[model samples]
Target: MKSVHLTEGRPLAVILRFTLPLFLGNMFMQLYNLVDTVIVGRFLGENALAAVGSTGTIIFLVQGLATGLTTGFTVLTAQHFGAMDPKGTRRSASNALMLSFGVILILTFFSTLFMHRILLIMNTPAEIYDDAYRYIIVICAGLFSIVLYTLGSSLLTAVGNSRLPLVFLMVGAVCNIALDLLFIPGFGMGTEGAAYATVISQVIAALVAAVYIGRKMPDLRPYRDFWRLDRGMAIRQIRVGVPMALQFGITASGTMVLQTAVNTFGPTAVAAFTAASKMSTLLTQGFAALGQSMAAYGGQNYGAARPDRIRSGVKAAMQIDVAYAALISILILLLLHPLMRLFFPAGTDTGKLMEFARPYIYFSMSCYIPLGMIFIFRNIMQGCGYGFLPMMGGVVELVARVIPAAVSMRLGSYLLAAACDASAWLTAGLFTAFAYHFYVIGRIEQRIRRGRARMDASPPAPKKE
Candidate 1:
């Protein structure tokens, strides 16, 4: 029953309230990942670390599908909520749950079946191939938990209850860290240990969220009769969800190609990249959180037929994102070495690691502004029920990233390979921004005009006195 209704408040305050929990939750998730990397690099050594890192894109490819689809599913739910249609909201949520579960099952089956082949295709080094296989296989087998957690959290966020999900994530992060220490060092489970820890933590979070929704959020619970598929509803969600899923897949596919290129440089480059990527991910959490807030904000306003408010929210969000990006970029560059040092042990030689990773870190920080804008516009458009354009933007990004990495491979330059992400963010940002401005915003303005016209044409009320 408790939710932040974005349709009623100051846009900036509402969005920031929504974003704070998301930002903190994301930071915790990143910290957990950072700890995992640190533990592996220090305890198991660089080859073990590289093995885990090599699987990042493959993991993203699978997990991103779940995230993207679930996100798409929730957009309709958010809209229904904003329209104050309880039945519509519950129906949308039910269908989303069923669809997401089905897709996750298929993904898990294929991913686990071909884990070794995927690693091989990524050009995983001979020394770390077996370890990578071990890690990713466990992760793939447990994809169900990830789906459950993502779907549940997304459902809650859709209704503007971001705080509970953050609490669940914090609990999961703590559990994950505890398990990581116990399994890796105490039980000597190696990379598989890290994988197990992650999966178990997700399971815990998912179960807790499910229980909470069942007991506390009766508004979201669909009746037994609502379980049956509604073809029209399914179509609506799929219309929005599938392109979003493909966007994640396509974007991840590009990262896979780039990862393959990185692997060719051998284990050291891979490890350095892994560390740098983790750091960049940490710094960008603010943007990601802000973007998510906009999706909910835009969705609710759109359903309420308040297109003008959506515009105002996007502008406010962009201003926040830009300022955060600027500040974080400067801070990251300042602390690059100190932060990079945390990935390894107290006395490990980081000379080679720094040499390979520093330039990549610099590129990431320098391009934060564009990257932040990419999240803002892309998510807002998706919230507005325009998935195809964002997916096309992802295609542009795929091309931008893959081309540079491929050229880097031919030229034998890691710097060139490192530049791929910056280029992708820039190109994709421009594409998304243009699409929003030229197409989506124009459509939104038409909605606003119609709303105003309807009001203007209405008959005046008689005086009560």
Candidate 2:
């Protein structure tokens, strides 16, 4: 049991070891999403699938916020782990858990209370509103499990241990798929059944991860020293977490705006967008897993004061991301229709809707490298305890989505909805590029300069001479 996942002294090995499990874990998580849709579409019909689709934006918003908090926890854990301070790591982990639980509770309460209102505001179709409301409410009610799982997993990833979480997620995903089949098809529970299955799976993941950490990861077990809340640590965690939360919230709000634009085009467009987005997510998971690897690798090394190794890790990540994105983009473009049909099925309006969505899918796929670069850069910044620039990237995404969406709706063209997405990626790419150069690269240079200055300012060793 090596204490830190990153041996700053060997950056590539650390990244590969940490990333492999994260990649598999993310794939399993995506399977959870795919299975939910498959169960709903196959068993409950298209309308039930639409109902689940209706709540996607809202769920992203809430889940994104929870994940942002988890990012803060990861940052703290990564830094402490890098510095070889187990006590500090434990304290940060405890505070992050407390903070995450509290935040999820508030989000769950309000989201459930305003479920109907939010759906209405999103212009969710009248036919699907009731089912959507039910689905969202159930999901919201189980927010604690979602938050806990994310928190625990982030802690593990932060400490360079992605395998434990990956194993637990695999178990949970299998259980979720079984439950989805049992509830939706066997029990005829429909959309509510899918939501219930998801929550149940999340709960299982959280419990399993928690037990594993408590038993295996001595650094994470809550002791009396860790139990005591330090005001300074709490403040630092919040300071880092809040902006990341806002970034996700803002980004999710833009997705809602895009959702509203899609809604105006009717259910066909909504269904198409939903299906396409799901496929895109599955593809992006490959790059995202790599990016997560970079975060842990970079953060630990940055903490360990190995700036050159951090730079090398980011470079390796960029190359991996670019190559992977290029391959994936080609595959997506070549197999668009067949792939879409698999998710949407034939002899249905979904297949036709997917045809309308082909252009959007192809265009978005072309930008995968840039999109991946953004993730790599953002995660590197996050690993280095810098959150504001990435938060600014969120602002860029929000404006790009909102303004284009508004214009497109006014123009009465659903095509603009896809355009807005591409534009947002382009805009976010610019910000990510700038941050990579100015913040990450610049910081590295500054550290080097300061080191030189200290040497120059040092007094002569005259006594030795």
Candidate 3:
């Protein structure tokens, strides 16, 4: 139940402490997806796996946009918390909830309406389209829960309440897995069953998160006026949220483009890539958690006007990023065989599938340090309430993926996949770092120096201890 006020703690220690539950929570979250994949792949077969996988990018597009908007709420809340302004924090939360619901309603309505067309635009395989359509529509139809759950999680984490979300997700994961078993194979529900399980679990988690905030964090409970729109705060909220949403959307679009190319390679290729992508996602969860923690950490310090803490926290985060990349790279290499065989049906071509996906894992492992950096640099800039450069970093990622993916598809799917992802990560990482260095670091230092000089010029207050 202990939550960190990161501005007052050792930068490295607090970040690591904060990141641990986030890491665990992300694992469970990824496990939620993995369970669905394993169930569908094992129960229904490769085509079903492809069907489920085919929707991943589109889901990310919608869900990522929701997450980005939620992050705007989180950054504001954390800033107010750091500054010891509970009323502002509560109001921010109220505003976030109201704004987010409007966004989610829009997303749910439109995405559900156009789900099939979007799938067609992605050039989904005809044989798998029915199954994919069933799953995507079910999921998108329930997109309201998805956005709510994600926003709830982000809100909780912003207050340094990472464990609550983790606990919720752990229960959700269990619920999801059990339901996956029952719905997929037990009842012969197939892809639709898996989608149902996901949506149901998310609703449970979101409900818990929503209720917990009201009960446990009374000060963070909004007053009636907090629910009414404040023009200035709403503008600030949208200002931060929109660019971040665009960043997620643009980056997801790049992956959507890659997904289209993967579809062209056949169902077998689709299945292999799906498994590998899941593995890559699972492996890098820690790094992503680190990024989220950094955003919270830096945002708190930024609100407290402590540039020194932000700098130190980011440095510590990058060090941890390196350690994580190295460890995960080795693990991926060591367990490649057994891991690859786990997702496929008993009689499927596990060997061929693993081999086909090998280059992606290998290349991704090699470039993970940079991938980790992208999460840090971009989110740190986001933490500081600066989004333009970070949004541009996402554009760089889009171009990096698109050119290689478009030009290299004829060479081989594996090579193209590897190049596309690796190039995107490296390019985005470099651009963000440059932006942080040039735009953020100097200005923060100047503020810190000016504050220090003013304090030096003024007479010190007498201690009354």
Candidate 4:
């Protein structure tokens, strides 16, 4: 009901405003994971930290696939809304709920089936394997809650009501933290408690958002027609969603390989990689927010046949993301010591873990520019419905991620782990730049020129002079 129309506005100001709530919301989401990390690390100890860390790649594999698939629904919702087609927007929104359910439902059944094998594939250390298994089990069972929240937040964002989701997200995150303190030390559930904390919090967020959206947003409200299946919408969703899912799956697979490489060094490397990864994710919340902004911005203009707005939006996103990258890099470097303290306590053994993990955060922070570029370009193009080149770039990133991690293993686990991330971001950024500039941007320009041509050929204007 409080949706913002992004079709005509000051590009940067509107995008920044829209992104602010989304940014804070994302940090809250990431903070949910951080709460797990910090609590598990403190209560269950560093090895416990490694157990949760070990599950990162596989969990991301699932989440990434879910996100990629559900993203189409977001784009479609935004497109219809931007075109001012309430009927189509409602139809798409209703269908999006179904689509979201279909994908995550299947994943929930299949992930639990393959959970152990997935861990095995990651080459999880024997010391932490059981711990990792228990944690992932709870998480896998409750993944639908996450899917529900992701779908709801995405739909709300599409309609330009990012603030509402942020409010609910904070509520969920606060619940998670309280539950973490209650479950872990209070109840002695250890790492499993942390997992339950995460799942329950996510469930709360999902249910709250769903109920509110059903009551408030006309496009998402359920009715008799909402139950009817639309073959055309379903088909369009698959055609778009499948490629996006593949790109995500492919990229995540590369990270899985890199994770396997990290596992080779035993629990210390896994724990370190985990801490670095949490920082990397949290630090780049701004960039992720910028990318999401571009996705919504590009989608709306494209739907309205105003392709000329896209280039300007892209330029603005690039500028914002680059600034974000620079700032995150500096802050991480400046606060490296205190930041590391969040996950590891002060001690000789903990200090060893810090040595292994802290470099990862520093190196990753330094490389934010390329990583930010990757997200911004890929997401905006995906929003514009340009799937092929973006999908191909995933393959480029896959090769980049794996080869370096594998080849650099001889240099030691830390370098090998950092190499995987650095190469993946750098390679993916280059590939996306080529696709975005030569293909995505070019087509939008062509469309804009043609739109202008039609305008010029229309009836002549009367001159007041």
Q: Name the top TM-score candidate.
A: 1
Q: What is the TM-score of each candidate against the true structure?
A: 0.96, 0.93, 0.95, 0.94
CA lDDT of each candidate?
Answer: 0.89, 0.81, 0.86, 0.83
Ranking by TM-score: 1, 3, 4, 2
lDDT of 4 at 288: 80
The top-ranked prediction according to lDDT is: 1
**What tens digits encode model 1's per-residue C-alpha lDDT throughout 1-465?**
486678988888888889999999889888888888888888899899999999999999999987898889889998898889889999999999999888888899999888878888788999999999999899999999989998898888888898988988998999999999999999999999999999999999999999999889866889998998778998999999999899999899999988999999999999999999988898899998988888888888888888878888888887898899889988888977887787776776788889889989888787888898888998898887889999999999999999999999899989988888999998998899899988998997797688889999999999899
TM-score, predicted candidate 4 vs. hidden true structure: 0.94
lDDT of 2 by residue, 1-465 (tens): 434557544555666677788888998998898889866766666667777887888999998888887777668778888878888889988888878878887888888898888888888889888888888889999888888998988888888888888888998899899999999879988788988999999999999989888888888777976776678998888877888888889899999999888888777777677778888888788777887777777678776767777778877777777788888888777876766666554477655676557867876887787788777887888777778888899999899889989987899877777877778887897788788876766786577568779979999787863
Model 1 local distance difference test score: 0.89
List runs of model 3 lying over 4 Å from the truth: 410-414, 447-465
Better of 2 and 4 by lDDT: 4
Kindly state the number of residue pairs that clash in model 2. Answer: 0
Q: Could you tell me how far off, in angstroms, the CA of residue 270 lies in candidate 4 after the best superposition?
A: 1.6
Question: What stretches of model 2 exceed 4 Å from their correct place?
Answer: 1-4, 9-13, 344-346, 349-351, 444-465
**Steric collisions counted per model:** 0, 0, 0, 0
Which residue pairs overlap in candidate 3's backbone? none
TM-score of 2: 0.93
When 1 and 2 are scored with lDDT, the better candidate is 1
The deviation in Å at residue 384 for candidate 1 is 1.2
